[model samples]
Structures are given as structure tokens and as C-alpha cells.
Target: MSAPAGGRRAAAVDPTTTVSRVKAADPRGHWFLLAVGMVLLACALVLNGYVTNVAGETQAPAPATDVSTPELDDVRSGGPVLNLTAGAASSAGPAARTVALTFDDGPDPTWTPQILDVLRRYGAKATFFAVGSKVAQYPDLARRIVAEGHEIGNHTYAHADLTAVSGWRLRLELSLTQKALAGATGLHTTLVRPPYSSTPAAVTLPQWQSLRAVAAEGYLIALTDLDTKDWSQATAARMAKSALPAKGRGAIVMMHDSGGDRSRTVKALDLALRELGRRGYRAVTVTGALGMPSAHQQAGGVERFTGWALNLAQRASGSLTAALSWVLLAAGVLTLARLGLFAALAWMHARRTRRGRRRRGIARWEAPPPVTVIVPAFNEEAGIQATVMSLVQTTYTGELEVIVVDDGSTDATADLAAALGLPNVRVIRQPNGGKPAALNTGIAHARHELLVMVDGDTVFEPATIGHLVRQLADPAVGAVSGNTKVGNRRGMVGRWQHIEYVIGFNLDRRAFELLDCMATVPGAIGAFRRSALVALGGVSVDTLAEDTDLTMALCRSGWRVVYEEKALAWTEAPTSLGQLWKQRYRWCYGTLQAMWKHRRALIERGPFGRRCLGYLALFQVVLPLLAPVVDLMALYNTAVGDPLPVVAVWAGFVVVQALTGWYALRLDGERASALWVLPLQQFVYRQLMYLVVIQSVATAVLGVRLRWHTVRREGTFGGTLPPQAAPQGALAERHPDAAAQP
Candidate 1:
């Protein structure tokens, strides 16, 4: 097959090429996209508050209504009721027989419709103060109010108290309400009602100052002469009595049609309007009763667009907020579930280890069988000598043969191994092939029944081979995963990997062992029976994760794969973030391929297929895919909501993780000082891992096959051998015969 447009062919590309010089298979465009998305989300969050405040301020009950008798006479002389520019108030009408009824906080689904019905029955026209948000929500009701010959007035969007808000907030409240009304019914109003305080005399000095500011915005303040007090009154009769004008004078009676159950208000309106008509008073709209031109007018083009924009924003914010909430909830549940499962399974494994030790009485020592240790090398010249020397000095009682397979290295990997000149070590060179092919070639040339596979960069302990081979004593066991540690863990990134190895990898391995669902045996160090290897057709190169594929194949064929915790091997991990990303991307993508290859196993009956496949699907595939969303939700919460709760939750999780890491380190006999970097790791390293998983999944879904990512080898483990292994200088001293050849 031809190489992908932006990728190199695995077979043709030189394995010695440094990762930094190679163009990454997929560029980091997704990171850019995610950053842009976060920016948009932040903007939306800020706008959400802005719009909400505007809605609240406009929707609050305006404390005053126009009630000046002289203004009513001016309005009767063909002036606008509540003069828009002069900031003058108008009363019900010039004559005592005319009355205007105004309702506030309305366009309610239930009460507003019933109130409209009562008005229609009585042939009355009144002004309804409509909240902007309610109009946005129920546009049809606002239209119905206008269509029935009744006037609609602005009540602000959210009914917020304007007296307590800033000047900008007050303007936003009124303007947004106007836009909402225009959008809903294509009508605008000039009348303004400042929420809370009643008469101009009743308003405080600061409130009066605020009122003047609002007047500067072309709003004519409206105040009520009579308040029905239906919002506070429990009975309809008392509310009606309170709304009646004194001495049959012109009055603007205030009532409400929303914000609460308005049944009493509706009943009071019914009785009060009837009584007013009987008392020779005519009920009409504010403009009609006052003999002034109607303030209601169709919205202009700009106002319509503004209204549409606000409505769209409200809808978008609601949807995104809900989605973020659900994602956060799922992330929390999954995180807790994983932590609980790991802790419980780790405890079980520890108990099992104690019991097994007690039953066996000091492990019942036995000489292990002869083993062939295969070290696959491709452009791994930097660490090949150390790796071979480590295996050559192994203290296993049984015979050991070390075969170094050089898969066409451009460097001196083969020549270096040949120069090693250890008695049991041999170097075999072949044309370039991948790691799987190299391993298969080495397996084909093995001279023993028990086989150990170690990476070209790994340095094993003196008793690592013996510890690994002992696990095969169980006839059902086909492969054993050895404990792999990060040898170059002095840097922050390296230290984070070390913690991950112990807590994330090893702890989970223990749990998988207990569940009999152990997944991958690391390529750095693992052992397998020769017959089992042959039966599985050696290491298959169908997936990027040949180790995982082979292990799963063994499990499917009813062979047990176990973990050997004492078979310690120190391997070099990628030190840079870029290298690490490339390495993990390959691993994740390869694991996905292998999982897909074994998809049928999910339905198969047995612990290997059922439990193991289910575990892989949930933890490896599913959870990693969900992790990015979890992180994004964390960011969203920190951006828009109270960050203290988010911080507390995150800190709590980190603390639990630290505790788990401490326990895992104790189990592995490692130091606890590394736990301090765990929290910091969450910000950068963990996010990188999540992104790798996301990119890998995206690549797989797009059907783009990624080539092998070669990591730079620094040979950091050359002198870091454990005390039980040959001394650091022994490779040079004991191999003086071969050491002189170079």
C-alpha cells in the first residue's frame, strides 16, 4: 500500500531517523481547535451572565406609573402619553371619568391567557407590562395581546431591581426588554417603569439620580395612582377594593399577571372593571385612557435583528450548559468508579499474595529451565551493549542464551553486539523489518524452550529471568509480564512516567491478574513459553501493539497470562513531551487496532473473552475517549461557575490518587517522594495523554494507519543496574577479552 499523504511508510523509512526530524503523522491541529472552542465557551459564559442580568433588571416590577393630571391634559392636546423626551409622567386621563388599568410582570402561559380572556369578554383594552424573557419564551402570547387590541409595555427582561444596579445594567435591562418585545410582537413602547420604588417622592436620592439617568435614555417614567396589592393580598374582594379610585377620579390601577399565581389578581380585575364601568368610568389602554398617541409601534430592522440575536444566544447557552453538566457528571462517576475498583482489586491482590506466601512457605525454590533472551534492535545502537551485558550477567541457575536481532540498523547496533563477545550472547543481522518481525526472527533462532523478550534499551536485574521463568511452573500460564520501571526518572516528565508505571500500569496489572484479564505484557520485558509462542504464530504485526495483540491471542486460546512483579527491568522512557506523545499515540492506536481485531471475543463466553474484553473496552477504550470531555468540563466549570467547588473536587481526587500512588509505591518497594509531582502532572502530562488518546481514536476512525514512531535512545540505564545485578563496571572488566576488540 502507498504511504499516507502526510505519513511515512513503516517498511521504507530508515528506523534510525530521529523522531524530531520526522514529520508527525498528524499535526497538532486538534489542539488548536480545542483552544478555539474553549475561547468561544468562555465568551458564551460571560454573555450568559450579561444577558441574564439584563433580563432580570427589566423584568422586575416597576415601582411607579404615570399619574400626573397636567401631563394627562398635555396628552389630550395630542402629545405622547408619558412624554418620551421630556421625562414627564401622565395620569389615567384628562377627565375624571376615564381610567387606565395596567398589568405588570405578565405574558404568563396560564394567568396571562385567562386575563386576556376576561379583557376580551368585557371589550376592554389595557396595557400589559411584558417581561422580555417571557416574551422570548412565549412570543405567541405577546402577539395575541397585541392582536386583541391591548397594548404591550416593557417590564424589563429579568425583573431585576434597577435601584441596586449600575447605570449600564439599567440601560441593558430596558434595551433588552425592548428588543425582546420587538422580536416577539414587532412592537416597541416609550413608557418606562423603574422597579421597586413607587412614587417619585417615595424614591431615595440615589434612586432619583438613577431615574434621571434612565430618563436621559428617552424613557418616560410611569407611576401608579392606585395599587391593587393583589400580589400581597390573599382575597380578590380586598384587592378590588384597594384598586378602586377615590371619589371616582381618574386613576391608573396597577396589578400583575405573572411572577406568581395571578388568580386573585384576575378575579380582582374582573370585579374592579365592572365596578368602574358602573361608576361612569371607562377602562382603556394607558394611551387610550389618557387621550394620547399610542407608544406601541412596529420594530425597525435593527431592533428585529437584535431581538433574534438575543433569543439565539439564550438557546445556545442553555444547550451548552446542559451538555457540560452531563459531561461533568459522567466524568465524575467514571473517575470514582475506577478509583474504587483499583483500590478494591489492589487490596484483593495483596491479600492473595500474603495467603499464597503463607501457603508456599518461602516460595519453595527450584532451578528454572534454560531460557533464550531475545533483544530486538533497530537503530538502537545506543543501549544494545548495556541490554546484552545485563542479560549475559543474569544469575539464573539455568542456562541462558542471549540473541540480538539487528533488523537492518543503519548504525553499529549489530557490530556492537558482535563485539560484546559474551559466551552465551550471539548477534544476528537481517534486513529492516518492524519490531514484531525482529522478535519473530529471534524467536525462530531461539535455542531453549523458555523465552524472554527484552527491549533493546532495557536493563534487567540479576534474578529477573529466574523470577519470570518461575511463573511458567503453572502449566496453564503461557506468558508472564515483568515489572518495567522508568530508568531515566530524574526529570519532571520522567518522574511522572515513573509514577504512572507504578500506580497506573502496575497497580492495574495486579488487578487484571486477580481478574484473570491481564492485557499487555510490556515490550520492555516479558517471558513466554516457546510452544505457546509457536502456537500463536509468533508475534503478529497486524497491530501497532504486537505485545498486546500476542497477549490477547494467548488469552483467547485459553492460556493464562500472569504478572511477575519481582522480574524488574529498567527501561528508558521518552524524555520530551513530543517524543512521549508520539510513543503513546502509537501504543493507543495499536491497542485500538488489536481490540478491534478481537472484537468477536466480547461476546464469547469465558473469563478471557468476557471479563478481559469488557475490562479493556471500558478502561482502555471508553474511558480514554471520555477523558478529554472530563478535562474540558473541568475548564468550563472553572471558567463560568464558582471555581472553589471545582478546585475542591479536583484536589480531593488528586489526594486520593496520591494515596493510591503511595500504596502502589510501597507495594513496588519504591520511594514515596515522587508523589509530590502527581498533582502538577495532572495539568500537563495527563492532558497530553488524554490528547494522545483523542488523536489516536480520531486517526483510527479516519482509517489512517500510523507508522512506527522511533524514540531517541540516550542509554540512561547503562550504569543504573540494581545492586543484585553485576556491578556497574563489571561489563567492561569481565568482558576484557571482547572489550579490547573495539
Candidate 2:
């Protein structure tokens, strides 16, 4: 019944093959998305207080330098305020028995407001050196400082130590602070305070030079004469006592309003102001004490515009961080939930399958049904011979026919397969049509009502067909999916595929069968009833994943599709990354198409819609899309934020996967030692698969049509049974774990 090799070709055309040209996926789309994501993450880091250091300094204080000079002597011996603007050196202080109270690191949402309330109650005016990053975060607080007769001064953009930074850094710090103030309250301050500075006597030679640089920029350095030491969390009485000027001398007292818990500072300020009022000492702003003009001035339009832009950028970054946080949380919860559910369902399925096997022990099929095996191949010469040989060697005690349909291969696939010359094996040569059309041709020519479909690169065990067809004994089952294993697991790529097949595919199948939510009967090995095929009008060529499409169609038609773990087949896996990407890209894209085509099933009353479709939508499409973003966040955290949490999370995820992988291998009768590769899969192989999903989604959304992608096979197990396959004349039950497989 075999047709001659290279028979006359037919002109039948496949609509899916009508695209103008075969194009690989555009690589720029995903790369561009990755770039945008990285940019957003960088902005997030800046606004979240990582780059700006707004969370406050924890480093040790700068040591005092022993070096001295004429300029250092003048600054160290001067009053609390120094003015060296325009090369002029001068010093000033408040009148005797008067105090100029100044607060640093402020405009705090908590203590600043309380400190301001105390000032208002006692009729005292003070100066607050506001951090620029804080002003941008709480503009209203900065404005309130000015509205209540309080003065604002620059504390650098992020409280950076001016003496430790370069000259350009000094300018940037002052400029950024001015801009922040301008944007928040439309005013800039001339008064400046270098962070970590105290009494004028502590001004070292290096500190004096930094002060000179600030003076050249036309800023008056406001140094503290009396230090309250409030930043160290000292007691209120001790701090209040420190603010008292010696011998009724004029002084500038320093305190803090932010940068940790400020409760003591708030009470200390209240106590100090009360004592100052009792002593008949008036508290005034730095400018009022020095008898100089107001330090605040209106900002120009350009400064205001630049400040506004910074504000917008910070706001956007904050919003993005917040959104990603929630998304990460949701993804974590959903992932854990899915893992738990799958494990539980798989266990139940295994239990039920074991029970069934025990009840049917020693029983055999009363009358074995005839079977037809169809192998639709195109340019699969590398493994076609082994595929046909495996089918012809099947030990089924029923009528069997093997059909190898060559869909216009430009290779010697037809010749090699027909050369076998097995009596029951046939070769049908036709013009190139896609896999679905070739499958339909095989179905039309099949003589048996029971049919099995296998790929040209797959080799099956002698008992595979018998185990596969036995599931059809149940009248309600329309199809059965066999277990497909990676045949070449000697390389890293092969090892990764092996783990994925055992964990992601086979484990999922076990659960899907229990829930009646089977989404796919992989093309490698699947069995179907001929009547069911006719009712569904044969396999549809609308999607690239004809196997998935047909399986979903059957589920929607109220037919049960079960998984048969005992029916094992070994298929060649792509050895290289490029070929793997192409194969998965087509799979993911075609699955998307099938899901879209069967969308109406969502509202239809059946498990197919409520369970299977919902599962695919959430776990397959939505979760995979979000995985990249989550992984990027993990990377960002590891690099910038705390890496402990990231490491802990990664370790936990791997532990869960390792446990699951071990269980999957045990159920499939594989060595548990293979789980060693599971961890490595997370770094490179997992990201590659995720990228495939991303590219496929982009292609689908853009309405781009793709030509069939053919993979190059190496004939890893050419024309031979896998080592683990049943021995020469042994029965399937003789396998050690045959009864345990489910």
C-alpha cells in the first residue's frame, strides 16, 4: 500500500503558508522593552532614597585635621556666622543676651511641625536648613517654614559633606537645593550650612577651604556656636541646658528636626525656648541676628521649570516603584498558590491511577482494536528512519498500520522511510502543505478506527502502542496523551529540557487530567478515536499548534482527554539555544492563537472553559509576561537594595522547585540525580524561555504571521530503542515502576 518515492506533487495550498516571506522575529522589540524597563528601574532607585542618601548618614564623623593656616585661624576664631562673598571676609553675631535658633536636616513632616508650633506659641523666629530631597518629597512643609516667619537655608541636596566632595559636587549640592526650594516655595536662600559642622573652633584647614569655595559662590556659612547635640537622642534637659549661652553671650544653637526619631528634639526645643524667654533673650532668624538683608529671594523662570521637571520625575519613579511592589506581591502569592495546587492535584491523580491499576491487575484487553499510526513529516530526514522503525517494531497483538506522509520534504525522508519496506508500513508523498494538512491526508487514508499520532523525530517503546490504546477502552475518553521524554540528555540544553518535560509538562498533565482541564496532547505522542476525528472535521490548520488546537476542540466538544504515563516515547530535543528558541516561539505563539480561537469557550458551561481556559490565561500568558518584570526587580534589589532578601527568596524558590523536580523524576522512573541541573535552569534556561514568551506575545499583538520553523535533528537515537525501553521480548508489566507510573 506504499506510494513510490518522489510521486507527482499536488498543487493544494495551505492558507497559513501564503505569507509573503519567512522572517525571523524582530529582535529589537524585546531589547527595546528591556531598555525601557532598565531606565524606569534606575529612576526608581534615585527617587526611593538610594542615590540621594536622604535616609540620613550612618558613617563615622570626619576627623579634625592638625594642619593650620592664616585662613583657618580667622574662621576658627570668628563668630557663629562667616561672610566671605566676593573675596570679603567678615563675621557677625547676635547682640548680647540674644539667641538665633537654627535647626538642621529639617522641614520634617513630624518634628518640624511640632517645633514650628512651639516657635509660634513663644513668638520666636528660627532658621531651618532644609535638605533638597526632603523639600521635593514634602513641598507643603517647606512652604510652612516660610509662611510662619521662619527662614530657610541650604543643607545641600542630600546632606552631602562639602569638604569630602569635589568642587563640582559642592556646586551641584547647592544648586539642587536651590532648585528644590524654588519649586516648592518659589524662593532661594543665600544662607548655607555644611553638614557635620558645629562650633567655629572646630573649623579645620580643609573645612576652611570648603567654606572659601562656598563663599566664592556668594553664600553665607551659618556655623553653630552652641551645640544642643539633639541628633544623638540626648535628654530634653541636657539639650535645653546646652542651648544656654555662656555669660549671657549671643549664640546660634543647632538642633535637628528629621533623620531619625525626633521626639526628644521636639520636647528639647520647647524646654529651651521656655528658658530663653524667661531669661529675656529673643530668638531670631540667622539673617536677623547678623543684621543682614533677608536671605530668601524669588527664583527665575528657568530654575522654576527645572525644579518642576525634577519633581515630576521623582513622582513618576515613586509611582512606578509602588506599582511594581504590589505586582511582585501578587505574583509571589499566585506562584505559591499554583505550586501548592499542582502538587496536591498530582498526588491525588497518582493515588487514583494506582487504585485503578490494582483493581485491573492480571487483566488484559479482551479484544485488541486495530490501530493506525500517522507520522506527518517535512524535512525530517535526520530521524525519519528511526521513527518508522520504532512503529514497525511495536508489540501490539492487533492489526496495525504505520503511515509516513512526506509533506514535500526537499530531503530523502520519503526514500529512507519507504526503503524499510515493512509490509504494514506505507509512505505517502505529497506537495508541501503544513503539518495539519499532511495529518488530514493520513486520517483520510487510515484503515483503522483507532489512531495514534507521533512526530518524525520520536522513538517509541515496543509496548507504547498497547498502553496508549488501552485508555480508549473507556467509552467516554476520546483521546489519550502519552508521556514524552527528552532522548538526548547528555548536554546542558538537553538536561534543561529533560527537567522541563518532567516537571512543567508531565506533572501538569497529571493534574490536568484530574481536573479535566487538559490543554494539550503534545505532537510527539497522542492517541485518538477515528470517530471523534471525523466529528471535529479532522485537524484544523488555523494555528501552528495543531495538536493543542485539536485537543482543545475535543475538550470543548465534551470529550474527555486523559494522560497515559505508561505510554512512553523519546523525542530528540534541540541541542542548541537558537533552535530551542525558534521551536518554543512557535509553540507559545500558536498556543496564544488557539486560546484566542477558543475564547468563546470561556463562557461556555464546561470544565474546559472554567478550569482549563482560566488556568492557561493566568498561569501561561499573564504570569509569564509578568515574570520578566519580577526577575528584573530581583536583580535590582540584589545590586542596589538589600541582597539578603533577594538571596533568601531565590533560595526558597529553588528549594520548592527542587522538591517538585525530585518528586516528578520519581514518578517518571528517572534518576533523582538529574535534579542537580534544576538550579542552573533558573539562571539562563528559564530566562531564555521567558524571552521566547515575550517575543511570541509581541508578534501576536502586532498581527504578524510566521512561517513554520523546522528544527535540525541529530538522529541521537536513530532507528533504535532507547536503553530504558522494554527488553527484547519483555512485557510492559515487567518494568520496575510500570505499575507506579501515572
Candidate 3:
């Protein structure tokens, strides 16, 4: 039964030398991508394909065949077009009459396999230009595409129309896809298909040239001659009508096998291929379709290509140098931004600590103080019932009243309130002056000495109110804030936002807690002392964001705002991009308005005042809206194959940030999944923060005003979880009566 020596040896293969395999979105995948990107970043962005098309003289039109064909207007009596172009033909072959059967938007789990099976049966090879995100989702399929003797082309990170995104963005998009694909396969890509087959037109002359210059370094275009229209039509008949050719002109048919359902496309491909076979014509690869020169010519062309290897290498070296320089510049800028934010945060923290520390002291001496809950409700009828009902069900011991203020709701926002019929919950109606005005009105009428503000559409844990109130018991604290999270987790959008909240609000709050100035107690679940709130003239609706205003005012008044991580509330995140944008726009506008409204606080140096000096340097002065622009610049430098050293600098900083974020989550005893996800939070998610900051600055500079109420899809919240449909590991289930007896 014992294995032979050879078999034993095979079983005992060396583990140390094995290359680790990674799945898509794997931590290793992310790190691997970061590393390869950094290295390729040094190698230059020329590996991505960009086609040069000459439309005019004096301008280097996209070097789309600088040797313009006779048909092109830009080409003149340049006696020999090929000689006029003055570049060697691609080592790929003499592409005189070849058309590659390229598949765009594919490697789908369903149809890709079928296509692969067909290609396998035919023993044919073709290039597959895949989207980065899709490839990221299905790396194995991408690997298989390459393994089966198919060339992999860069389609884009997202299938964005690159032609429209001319200039730096276009180049950057190509670079991102190329880098990601190369990182995936460890082989640089030299082919690309812009989304929608978009090409740089005459309007973007420099962009075209830049794209061409980058492409010339390595990649080549497999331009299309025929349209498949698979994604558009999708029906088998329509797909056949659009795809099957009339046996005349050899074609490069465009097809999609991914991005939603492509079953019909798959069925159509079978019919089309069979019909083509039935005819005298053949269905062959692009290389075969274009009669390529023999093996010797291919070898000779490769040999000829080696002649310019040194030149390409030099160009790569130059590009890497440029990239390193850009990275350095970016790091410097980001450092300035980080430093400025730090100073601002520190100043803000100092003021909060001055007030909060005393409260901490008070908590040590006495039982927790009572809390005033400020519920700033705009037009939130969709989910207010569940939110209020949940509040009534909380098991808190503190004397807390939910103050619901109507902020010019055009819907049945006010009607929903009276329907709830709770003794402790008080309803206040104010003119639709916006959130701040409503909060100010509620603050004025609040009966409790302590004020706690919750969004009318947010639900709380049974103990969240008590936990938040206890934090404020500390006499040193002017206010206490709890965690706000997405309660509605029905879609990919909600889950993504959930992760964002965990990474941003959860981790950032902990850091802020450590610093002692927990900035704005979100309007969603903020508890403030009545006097401290009134002292700031209630929440000032003059500013778009009253929460930010209140925090700054508390800082100015030497009041400490403490972050109570244990206090948790669940709220809805906007399910759509448009809604999210509107919410952020209002937030940005409000932040700017509040900053200007309380500009005096920047100069003041009280426990609250002096802290603002740091605030100014760290937040408002150096970094405020610059992060995104800096990122855009970094991406641009990368796209142009420039030397940028800032990538490393930011890499280190983000690593530290991610580690800190993980630590904060650990301290809070949150889900461990956040640890793995925090790093990605920076790559894709932090960019959102950059947008928020920019919008804030732009709104301030432009003096833009935003209305509070945003349109919403009616009846979009709190559908009862169907039988056996409850979420896995959901929060403790409450009886129907737990909220309010329906």
C-alpha cells in the first residue's frame, strides 16, 4: 500500500518555492495589484493601446497610423503611404487583411465558458478585451482566456466610453486597465478596445497624440469592421440579423459576453457560427482572416522589433522617472493636505476635550445624566414610522424624548408622526427652512435639559439611547455621538455603503475620540446639553449643515464632544447615486456655510477656540478640497507614464490609515470582515470623501445654496422580512410590538 519513491517525491513537492495563487478581490490580489502597479508605474504606461488617427496636418492627430491611408483626408500624395508613416510593421504580423474575433465585455460565468468551449472545439485563438472590474470578479476566467492561447486586451477598468473622456482622463483610463490586466497576467497588454469603440476625434488633438504616444510604446488596435450589437438587441433573431455577415467582406465583429444577461448572445453565436460554417466562408481568428506572412516573416519582424527595444526601454525609463516625480509631488501635496487636516482636527479636538473631559469626570462621580434626543426630519415619511416605533421600543433608563421636527416635508411626513401616537415623542412643525432651521426650532422647544438628536428615519438598538446618554453624563462633555449605519441592506449599493460607513464613520470617529474633539455629532444620533445647544442659537439653518455648525459652536464655547462608539443606531443610506449625490451636495454646501458663518472660531483660542488654529491648518487651509484633485493628478501622472514618487508616500500613509482603521474596529468589537475590507476602502471608497471635500470647497467659492428635501421613492423602507428571508446574523429580532403595535 506504500507509495513508490517517485510517487512519494511527487507528493512531497517543495512548498517554499510555490507561487501563491489568489482569487479576485483577495487581499493578496489587492496587494499584488498595488505592487505590480507600482512597478509598472516605474515601467511606463506605454503598454496600454491607444490608436492614433490623423485628421489634420501640423497636428500629430492621434498617431492612429501616422501613415494615413489613401481614404483618409489627412493623407497627402505622400507617394508611399507606408514609407511616409516611417514605422516598422508590428511584429504581430503583416496585418494587411486580418481581423481578430475579439469579445468585449465578457468572460461571463455563463456565456464565456460556452464561447471558450466553441473556441476550444475549433482550436482557434483570439484576443479577449476584458473590463478590469469584471476580470477582478473573475480572474480565473481571465487566466483561462490567456491559458487557452487567447490574447487578453485591456477593455477598461470600468467599461467607460474613453473617447468622450479625452485628455488626461482618457489616457488614465487606458493606463488603469493596462496596469490592472498586466498585474493580473504578469504580462503587459498591447491591445485595447475603448468602450463603445469610442475613438479620439478631432476635438481632442493633444489627447489623441498623447494616447498615440503611449500606445506606440507597445499596444496595437484591433479595429472593428462589423457590429454584433449583442448587448443592445440580445434576442437571438436580432443578434443573428446584426452579427451574421453576407460572405463578402472579412469582418471584426464586436460582441459582448458579460454585463448582465448574454444567454441570447450565446445562442446567437452558435447559430451565427453554424450558419457561417454552412456557407463556403470560414469562421477564423483575426490573424487567420488577415493573411499574415509565414513563420519566418514573424521571426524576422520580432528580430526587427528588438532593434527598437533599447529605445522603448529608454522611453520606459523616462516615463518611470516622470511617474516617480509625480508620485513625489503628489506625496508632498497629500502630506500638506494630511498635515492641514491634522491641525484642524487637533484644534477641534482640543476644544472638545476641554468640555468633554469634565463630563467624563462627572460620569465618574454620578449616575448618567438625562439625554435630549433631537430628531431633524425633512420629508421622510417613507421610513419615519419604523424609526419612531423603534425609538419607543428602546430599553433605555434615561429620560429621553424624541423631538420630531418637520422640515418643510412635501410628503405625509407630519401625518406619519401623529399616527405613531407615542407619549414621549414630541412633534414640532417648522417652515421648510431646511434641517438646521428645524433642529433650531426643536432645540428651542425641547423640554429636557439634555438634547439628543436622531434622524426621524433611523432605528436604534434597544440600549443605544442609554449608552449615548451615559457618555454625556461626564460633566466635561458638551455632547456625545453614537454610530450611524445603514439599516436597509437589500442591495449591492446598500452593502457597499455599509462597508463605507464602517470604514469611515466607525474608524474616523475612534481616531477623533482619541484626539478628544469628536467633530460633528451626526444629526442622525447626536445628544447635546440643552444650554450648550441654545447658546449656539439653536441649530443655525443659515448654514446648510447644522450638525457641523453645532460642533464648531461647541468648540468655540469650550464644550467637549465625546464619541461613544458603543452607541449604535441604524439609518438608511441613499440607495441610488443621484440621491447620494444630492445628500452630499447639501452636506458640502452646509459645511462651507457653517465654516464661513463661524469664521471667528478659527481665530479664537479658548479650549474650543485655540483648537481651531490646528483645525484651520489641518482641515481648511492645506487639504480641504485638494485630496481628489491630488488623486486625479496622481492618476494622470500614472496615465502619461510619468515619474511619480508620491505613490509610495501615499502607500505608506494609507497603510497606516488602514491599520488604524482596523485597530479602531477591533477596539469597538465590530465584525472582523472590516479588517480585510479597510484597505480597499482607500482605493475606491476614500475617493468619495475626496469628492465631498471638493464639492464643499466649490460650493463655498461659488456661494451655492441647497434645499434640504430630496425626492425619494415612496414606500421604499421597512418591508417585513418575508418568512425565511431574514438576514443572516441580523440584530436581535424584536416582536412586532417592539416598535409600535401596528
Q: Which candidate gets the maximum TM-score versus the true structure?
A: 2
Identify the leading candidate in terms of lDDT: 2
Every model's TM-score: 0.81, 0.89, 0.49
The TM-score measured for candidate 2 stands at 0.89
Better of 1 and 2 by lDDT: 2
Question: Candidate 3 at residue 325, lDDT?
Answer: 55
RMSD of each: 7.7, 5.7, 25.2
Q: How do the residues 161-211 of candidate 2 rate in per-residue lDDT, one tens digit apiece?
A: 777888998898888889888888889999999888888889877778888
Ranking, lDDT, top scorer first: 2, 1, 3
Model 2, runs deviating above 4 Å: 1-30, 46-58, 65-68, 86-89, 246-248, 360-365, 641-645, 719-742
RMSD of 3: 25.2
Candidate 3 lands at a TM-score of 0.49
TM-score, candidate number 1 = 0.81
User: lDDT scores for all predictions?
Assistant: 0.76, 0.83, 0.57
Summarize candidate 1's per-residue lDDT along 359-429 as a digit string, tens digits. 87333326556889999999887888778878877767778899998988999889988886678888888
Worst 10 residues of 2 by lDDT: 1-10
